[model samples]
Target: MSSTALIFHIQRFSIHDGPGIRTTVFFKGCSLSCFWCHNPEGRHAYSEIQFVASNCIGCGECVYVCEHHAHQLKDGERFYSRALCVNCGKCAQNCFSGTLELIGKRMTVKQVMDEILRDSAFYESSNGGITLSGGEPCLKSVFIRTLLEQCKQQNIHTALETCGNYKWDKLNSLLPFTDLVMMDIKLMNPDKHKQVTGDSNKRIITNARQLVLTDKPIIFRTPIVPTVNDTIEEFSEIVDFIEELIELRLKRGKASTNDANIQLELLPFHQLASDKYKHLGQDYKAAQLIPPASEKMHELAEIAKKHAIDVKVR
Candidate 1:
């Protein structure tokens, strides 16, 4: 049988994902469950039903269409009974009002390639291509490798946005076809990282160390969460770590100070995905936290700059 992956979303014409314009394919499943994760729907490995209550309009369409009686209208409000749902996608198919929706679907490599190839003209004009994002794209290593290989066959530039929390062997297999790797370093402290993200930093740090050794360009990103991993001390430690990695590269004659193969991008925290949490029937733990002001982002950028590394606030 042809290999297929469970994917949550395919965002097109995206400027923030990579250079110029790009299409970001969000794969389902992840190793970590960070409290502030924006895409709660993407975390689960299996397909999930996302119920948007406000959009239902107390419509009985889902109840009528679902053969399993997974949906019920209770006192002018809609409720989705998870126990009865077989994930047949029947209710979602008839959901014209956009209340009940399936979050993930299986897609073959060829099927995904066709979707991205449709925007070939845009990619050519803007010097952009396909980017595999997640729920940790590396989780589905074989599927991602095949997709990356296919993209390369078509001369499409490929990038991977990862949290850097996967097995080293899995990542090594994908880099040969990847042109750029944008990884997130959520926290410098191992214990704190484990506390918030529910995973230790050992694996992520190790993977990144090996990733930089490769020829592909690397972009180190961090979502600056206030009172979590955002502190002057934390940023200083991060810069020091990057400086050490650059030294290692120089020692091996793999990179130079002027090479610009590595860069840092600080992503400000945002509450934009709070509603997504509600839709996914999950709590938005960071609801009260506001996005860091531009000035604050710049202030941290200055700290990163002091290490003589190219840094930007995105």
Candidate 2:
């Protein structure tokens, strides 16, 4: 196997990423630049630094360690001058407390599998498996495919959380080894999709259709952002699109009557990425982006239920 991936984090004991408890391998790099991305650090494929000023004790340790004077204290507050910083990671290495941190690391398939296998007992007990997520796993197709092959060799269930923005060929290369594909359907309107995600929806929709045709288990995830995609009409359009797909599959004899049992999950947006953006020296455009109200979430669920599609809110 060849080394070809830049991974950000390998989160263990994660319950929400997939079934039961899972070890999620977050790949670095993304095709879309969504306005309200939660994992901003994973957007870039290269290594980057994050400054968490709260963790800093004002000991001026980073300033002393930075030969380039990338860090300095002004008015008793430490400020990081990103322009002068070389991302050498010397400050992070020398800091006693985790005030400065580095994000994104390169890892090979063998190395990541070792970490996953270490927690095999937990995966077995909880029906958990390995989930490949990221900036976009499809960006590192070769590495993902190899990682999935190794996991299957160990009898580990594999899942992928994707933005569904890749070409059909790129996605199909990994589906045989993937047990579950959890994808995000950001918007149904092509122009609006581009406006919000910085990419057109043609590829995403095509890939999703192909996945459904393959009879692979797929979970459609929609993030409910506040002014972007949080209207009843928007939700209804998504529900209708999914229903149409099922209907089309039935017409083509690709799906059984029981296939109507497929469910769509609605994920309410949250502000978890606000601080992460600041840490990465990026602006938070959606600072006031609030999650949908509880009543609205239930209302959307009811709407999907009326369409005879199972709906879950998380």
Candidate 3:
């Protein structure tokens, strides 16, 4: 296993990520540049600095610690010079108030596994395990494969929450060890997908279709973004595509890839990521967007259910 990979966050006892109380390891870096990215800090492959204005105490500790003079305090207000900062995390280290933060770090596979293993008791009791999530966990194929293999050795359930925007081989390589795959289908229209995410949906769609052919339980999710894919027609198109994949798999006589193992999930859009974008010095493109109402989400779920697919709004 590779000794180190860039990691942005590790959320423990996370129920929304997967079944029961799973620990989610967020791998740093993403192939797509979605305009409404929640984890802007994780979008970058390398380490970056984040500033929290509210946490600043107006102390000059960071200014004293940063050799690059990246931290500047004038008239009690703090200003950061991003150009001069090396992202060495010195300011973050000195900021005891949790104002300055270093977003990503390099950690070995063993290091990650050890942290996941800490919650083994909870996993065994709650039928929970480890979930590999990220800016896009599929991007770190080999590392995730190794980590999942280790989890399987310990009889831990493994789930992958991915964007499904990688090569087929990378997704294929990890299928054997993955028990559940939570894939995000942002938009159906290729042109609209590229326009919003800065990447074509061809690879993502292909990966999803291929994943349906495997035995692992698959949950297809779509974040209900207003003006992007909130309309019934957009979600209806996605359901049609999934139904086709299921039909093809059945025709192939792939017993494991039955429709029963496939599920549809609808995630409502939220402004939670807006704060992260502010910390990263980037504007939140979807700041004005509001989360879909429960009725709207239910309507979308009903459409998916009409196709005989299990649907949930989470």
Q: Ten residues in a row with the worst lDDT in model 2?
A: 254-263
lDDT of each: 0.87, 0.85, 0.87
User: Residue-wise lDDT of candidate 3 within 175-211, one digit each (tens)?
Assistant: 8899999988888899999999988899988888788
Q: Note the residue pairs that clash in candidate 3.
A: none
lDDT, candidate 2, 49-119, per-residue tens: 88888888888878888999999898987788889988888888888778888787778788899999999
Q: Estimate each model's TM-score.
A: 0.96, 0.94, 0.95
User: In model 1, what lDDT does residue 213 have?
Assistant: 75
Deviation of model 1 at 140, angstroms: 0.8
Query: What CA RMSD would candidate 2 show?
Result: 1.8
Q: How far is each candidate from the true structure, as Cα RMSD in Å?
A: 1.5, 1.8, 1.7
Candidate 1 ranges beyond 4 A from true positions: none
| Model 1 alpha-carbon miss at residue 92, Å | 1.1
Best by lDDT: 1
Q: Candidate 1, overall lDDT?
A: 0.87
User: Candidate 2's C-alpha lDDT?
Assistant: 0.85
